[model samples]
Target: MIYRIAMHNLSNPSDAEDIVQEVSLALLTKCPDDKDDIAVKHWLIRVTINKCKSFHRQFWQRKRESIDDYLHLEAPHQRGVMDEVLELPKKERNIIYLYYYERYSIRDIAEILHINANTVSSHLQRARKKLKSILTEGGTYHD
Candidate 1:
């Protein structure tokens, strides 16, 4: 899950794997042991987001990496939709992934992304429109 999130945002498999490693290390050394299942998942999602944000702002971002890594993480059937989702800007992409793929509610997405619920809603709507247009252009969308 973390890898998928990182890959979508970074567009590089190696960097996504790096994110997964960092998150795993943090979970081992820093995550609270008392948290429940859902709480742990949220914690992971937050840490992954922070790591990806940090990654984007750092010097290491200059190195070229490939999307080849993404091919194995997702099922064959999901590849098409995921390719379209990757067209979205990072914010909307994250929201879309969390909402549809991770099955989080709008409120949960708001909390996860540290924005208001209304903002999340607006982004989701906008992202849906953009994805629809992209899919329609590809001749895959239907009413």
Candidate 2:
């Protein structure tokens, strides 16, 4: 799960692997002993997001490229609707991945992301709208 989030955020496999390793080390050295499974998962996700944000900033400091160029570098199998999902704004992509792929409730997503539940809902709605448009235009995805 952490790897997927990092991959989606960084769009680079090596960076994602590094983040997973960093997060795992942090978890091993600092994770609270009393936290339950759900809490641990939430903590891991939050940490992964922070690391991804830091990496993204560093990447921008190094260079810039068109979205099209980045897309071209994506794994060959991430085509069609998956590609469109990858094209989403970071926040929306996170929400969509958690809500649909991870099956996280809006409230759960809110707590994990440290945002209001209504905000999570709003992000989901907007993401769905954008995905609907993209998929429909290509006739590649449907309800």
Candidate 3:
């Protein structure tokens, strides 16, 4: 799950692996105080996202091509859809991943992302509309 989220965010297998390793180190060093399983999951997610965002700020990120050379979905069309998803703005992309792939409710997504439930809902709605329009029209995806 962590690797998938990292892959979704970074779009590069190497970078995603780096993120997973960094998150693992964090887990070893700074484990969350809460013993609740849900809280730990959320903490790891938060840590992973923070690491990905920090990675984006590095100067090298601008020079690297955003490509997933390692991921080959079972269906050819899944790759196309994933490419479109990768093109989405980061916030909407994360929201979409959480809502759909993670099977998270809007309220749960809101809590996980530390945003208002309405904001999460709005993001989800807009992301859906954008995906629908882009996908239904053709394979063309615009930034």
Candidate 4:
């Protein structure tokens, strides 16, 4: 699950491993003793995703001297079109990662994110359009 989240976010193996460990520790510490089996699992997954988002935010908040240097240094080694896909807005990026990388159905994503399925679908649509545009345009090409 952590692997999937990391891959979907930026395809960074180390980041994914870190998230997995973070999530595991969080579960160990924060998991409610009285929660049911399903609830425990759900809580773990939710926290895992939040951790991935946190990691992304932290990475983006760095004080790099040059944008190009930052991109070159921070870009994760991912599969085809990863750079393009991540160029989409954060909401779109999260929706796509949840659906594709995490293998969550629309309903599952909605439940996980506490949003409606329609909203999830809308984000997915927008993400797809943004991704297609990025790829067709041959990358966002930020300098």
- Of the candidates shown, which would achieve the greatest TM-score relative to the real structure? 3
How far off is residue 95 in model 2, in Å? Answer: 0.7
For model 2 the local lDDT of residue 85 reads 84
Off by over 4 Å in 2: 59-77, 133-143
Residue-wise C-alpha lDDT for candidate 2, range 15-127, written one tens digit per residue: 77789999999899988989999899999999999888888667443443333444454665555556678778888889888877788989889999999999998888888
What local lDDT score does residue 26 receive in model 4, on the 0 to 100 scale? 85
Give every collision pair in model 3.
Answer: none
Error of 1 at 41 (Å): 0.1
- The C-alpha lDDT values of all candidates are 0.82, 0.79, 0.81, 0.66
Could you tell which candidate, 1 or 2, scores higher by TM-score? 1
Better of 1 and 2 by lDDT: 1
Lowest-lDDT window of 10 residues in candidate 3?
134-143
lDDT of 3 at 2: 86
Q: What is the lDDT of residue 126 in candidate 1?
A: 91
Ranking of predictions according to TM-score: 3, 1, 2, 4
Candidate 2, residue 138: lDDT: 41
- Model 4, span 1-143: residue lDDT tens: 55565545645655666778888888889888999876776677678767777886784533323223323344444333666675676567777776765567888878877889999989887777766654335434211
Reference-based TM-score of each model: 0.81, 0.78, 0.85, 0.61
- In candidate 3, how many Å is residue 70 off? 1.5
Better of 2 and 3 by TM-score: 3
